[model samples]
Target: MTGSVPVHLEVDRGAVLDGDLVLPPEPRGVVAFAHGSGSSRHSPRNRAVARVLQEAGLGTLLFDLLTEDEERTDAVTAELRFDVPFLAGRLVAAVDRLGARPDTAGAPLGLFGASTGAAAALTAAAERPDAVRAVVSRGGRPDLAGQALGRVRPPVLLIVGGLDTEVLRLNEQAADALSAPCTLRVVPGAGHLFEEPGTLAEAATSARDFFLSTVPGPIGT
Candidate 1:
């Protein structure tokens, strides 16, 4: 595909996830997005970043980490969203699924995570270091990843809003724990959501540049 295509991924134990996959021709790499908190594939911020990646000749997979029923339950209990291990497992499944697909097989893989999803992305990258080449987090809670942060082998780019001080500090601490090459970027005048006028664009551009430089380009390109 050229446009966003709907996909169903069977992650774990018959738990299927809905997603939208957008691929550019001869993409340099494929990025799997993990939305934070209770957010799903429809998150406008993640979708915006995905579009930027697609425009830059990278494929993007935006998927839900939880099932509909689980979402309903999480809405009330607020449990599943914070379970980093569970979310990371689902993300690893998605990564493996993408690796096995004909269109994305052999492509350099990356993860783009937001909020708590960032922690899950780091944990998943640690589990699949041989497969994941790069990682990028936007206003993420990488500290929540805990011990797994030290195991991530791929280069990491953690983007934080300048105004989101607590999260920025957490990312700083997470960076100190990472042995892999890691860069912490701050988008000035932006809050946790990057809702400011041009901050999200800056973060998106930084992500694009990082993936382009770190994730290996297409073979023979």
Candidate 2:
């Protein structure tokens, strides 16, 4: 695998988000991460999954959804983190930015989202039907996407912790609303955070396999 580098993405003209971009040699596809509420690109769990994908020859982009100032405000008011539409717009912009980059332009695009970020990923996939090839949500709140769930065209994988009952039910509801192919898998003994022994590794492996199968490319090319 090639070295990963820090990147500053301008999702809007003046709005920048911090990210880390990792490209493997002859990567087959790229997966962009949408972290949950109160999380950033630095999330250790997402980072761990990103490492697995990179080793498998899939490029990964882990970016913050909110600007530094916005995060601070949301910390106090707890409002903007749940704004699905707003977060979706940012995700779409990030996808566009990835497509525009020479190193990643030819690779198929996928999204991996966690928590409320899963809703944003679903909404963005619905918005850009042709751009996103696949989506995977880890312990996510996909039901928060509302009507947008029906519009998504890419195959989706919803990974829920077996112990996270409420979220599992929500994922099932969201799956029923989807028009595209969708699957829900539960990691036994895992909680919302997948903190149980070996559960997170299992989740990451599932995500890697799903993207590899759904994205049209020669793996490790």
Candidate 3:
């Protein structure tokens, strides 16, 4: 009842991306998660959201954006967090692999991103329009995606914590720069991580609705 389907993706840059592929017993669509800076596929909050999506019949992909050595090296300086393009490229390749799978072939593809991961996710969406359907950012930094924001064509949902004021301003700014259809939802009294009880649930609910509305259709009829 609780398990994962593992997968490996080779990036164009020669690095391998490791991930967990979890499919619903009968899936409606597929969601590829982009973990925030300093976080990985094992993030409890994202894993919590993944569990929610799984129960809702959506497939999930959770991966580490950095290698163990890179993580150790960057952990001291937090330098890798700004590698948006690098992470985005890896996501594109991962999507290509998952989107081609028999189980995911016919399902709409969505991106669920957190924190700095949101920046990379949006950047990837801009680059791979043909593959990404919908995008959701949770307490995320979509603004960091930079000019790539102008190229994102998929519907985007930015979920922010009401208590996280500065980020809200940034999300608002990024939302405006995005020509793609987008919405911003703020969770009152919640901080950047949405650790408040029921806050993450609320974020997950908003994300689910966005994916259901923006993604294409049911898997292969």
Worst 10 residues of 3 by lDDT: 212-221
**TM-score list, all predictions:** 0.97, 0.97, 0.94
lDDT tens digits, residues 1-221, model 1? Answer: 49888999998878999999988778899999999997999999999998888889889999999999999999999999999999999999999999888888888899999999999999999999999999999999999999998899999999999999999998999999998899999999999999999999999999999999988687333
**What digit string (tens of lDDT, one per residue) describes model 3 on residues 1-221?**
23797887776657777889898666778899999988899999999998888877788989888877778989998888788988787788888888777877767789999998999899989988988988999999999999999999999999999999999999999999998999999999899999888999999988887887777467776
TM-score of 3: 0.94
Q: In model 1, which runs have C-alpha deviations exceeding 4 angstroms? A: 219-221
Return the TM-score for candidate 2, rounded to 2 decimals: 0.97
Candidate 3, residue 62: Cα displacement in angstroms equals 0.5
Off by over 4 Å in 2: 218-221
The residue pairs in collision within model 3 are none
Model 2 residue 28 lDDT score? 84
Residue 148 local lDDT, model 3: 97
TM-score of 1: 0.97
Answer with 2 or 3, whichever has the higher TM-score: 2
lDDT of 2 by residue, 1-221 (tens): 77778888897648999999998768889999999999999999999999988888889999999999999999999898999999999999999999888888868999999999999999999999988999999999999999999899999999999999999999999999999899999999999999999999999999999998987584423
lDDT, candidate 2, residue 46?
98
